[model samples]
Target chain A: MKSLAELQAIKDKMKDKVVLREGTGEIRVVVGMATCGIAAGARPVLNAFVEGVNKENLSDKVTVSQTGCIGICQYEPVVEVFEAGKEKVTYVKMNAEKAAQVIESHLKNGNVIEKYTIGANQ
Target chain B: MKELSLNILDIAGNSVKAGATKVGITITETDETLSLVFRDNGCGMTKEQVENVTDPFFTTRTTRNVGLGIPFLKLAAEQTGGSFSIESATKEENPGNHGTTTTAFFYKNNIDFTPLGDVISTVTTLIMGSPGIDWVFTHTYGEKETRIDTSEIRAVLGDDVPLDSYEVIEWIKSSLEEEYDSFYK
Candidate 1:
């Protein structure tokens, strides 16, 4: 029951924030979407990141993409955030709700959610 | 995958990796069945490769020992009491190099077949990830139908517009949404 008018309004309102991703130092959020990841619920997680970034108006600052196996099938539905210079942060066992939290706390607030990070266990 | 659109995306990603310059996707929803077809002019698999593609233990990638996309799709189809198939001719197998075709059909009455997810996202993501690849998408329901060709859009927008731009993406999404909206009406 969604409408195109809604999407058009978003395009008009955020016209200025479009970031040309060519070395703009934009943050990259990659979802592991290979066979394992997809089977383990990566689609909703990917969708969450995409919708969250757009809703939060962080599209210019963050790029959402998908990648092949991250070599960790047990921790399926993995999401990795790569900032300009910081070490990449990998979040495992992610779901849609947790993805929204990542977008809000880590991406917007500039504070990594340590509890969700790969280092949480370490 | 929990959504049919997501499965389509994953399977099409394989076509992209096969060095396909173009991928044609067809979705037809009728009163009795929903069918999906993906045809790609890519470096196709050999018979041996095709035989093992649906096996969870087999994969061509060294990064992982299992390939789940095709196998999952097959399971989904069978679970719905539908059918699935993939056929391809390797470049060397033929002179003109006909490529791969993957197809799936699900009975409309089947409860296990996942509903088509956000198709607009699946399509735009395909275009964004593989720039310069032409995508011919066709959707049909009942007597109504719509077709979108990326090549045509590119011609209209010219070089001044990047296909992945926010405006372009919204435009494509809106157009598709509009078409589908009218179909259901």
Candidate 2:
């Protein structure tokens, strides 16, 4: 079990290092976390994004946060990626495996994973 | 919703939105039964309110409700050869102090148990992921049982955020599945 003191420490350490909402050159990865989203496994998907970014050393360039309902309950566990200078890509029905790919190709290499994107499904 | 877990999340969200400080969720499984009970210390509803909660048309929030959450929970429980119930009590000291508790139970042989694992995961994940909310979850598989305390995790993570990050989510998922699978098998 992790503790709150540790999180505060991390937050304290992060205060000067990372600006949360600057939206400058940072890559934003947003996970839908509403009731519908969580039910569809958003928690794991969120985790995968955090881990993938941290592991690949893209923590500074990428920021992950959660949002409320997307109103598309059927296609939940949704993740949206907004790069510094690209169109926003929304991925639906995401799991951990798919999230990893998003981190690698889309977040890091600037290539979207077509099959996982909303446009591909349509 | 398509998945039962979604329904649980929706209902639990209601409890939080209602100003609930503590929520209790229990999942019980036996050779003959499986059940889910969600109890919240939020505002209790009147008889009329309770009756209309499942109507899918009476929403307190301007966000457009149709009361799908509770009704969905009721339907899920019934489809599995179980039943649903809601009870509330008005606070005597505090005029507006009240709470509502909903319980949905399913008998094992009544509905397909294929989704049982998913349901458990959904509820556990939702409870664990939310912060400032105290939840006690109990899972019983025949004679084997376990309980998770969100406060313990909260103690570790502190007040900055209530949920564990992605790494913690994976750890929790595997840990829960490992515990439940032992009884499931």
Q: Which candidate is the best by DockQ?
A: 1
For candidate 1, give the docking quality class from DockQ.
acceptable
RMSD of 1: 3.7
* Native A-B contact fraction in model 2: 0.22
| Candidate 1 lDDT score at position B125 | 71
A1-122, model 1: which lDDT tens digit per residue? 23435544555554444434332537999999876787788877987887788777777678888788899888888999999878999999899999999998999998998898877844
iRMS of each prediction: 5.2, 5.8
TM-score versus the correct structure, for each prediction: 0.85, 0.71
Name the regions of candidate 1 deviating beyond 4 angstroms.
A1-23, A51-61
**Candidate 1 lDDT by residue in tens digits, B78-124:** 88899999999999997497689999888878888788878877887
Per-residue lDDT tens digits for candidate 2, residues B11-38, read 7777777678888878777777767777
Highest TM-score scorer? 1
| lDDT tens per residue, model 2, A1-122 | 22345545655554444334233447888888765676578877976887788789776678777676777778888898887667898999999999988888888898989898788776
Question: Clash number for every model?
Answer: 0, 9
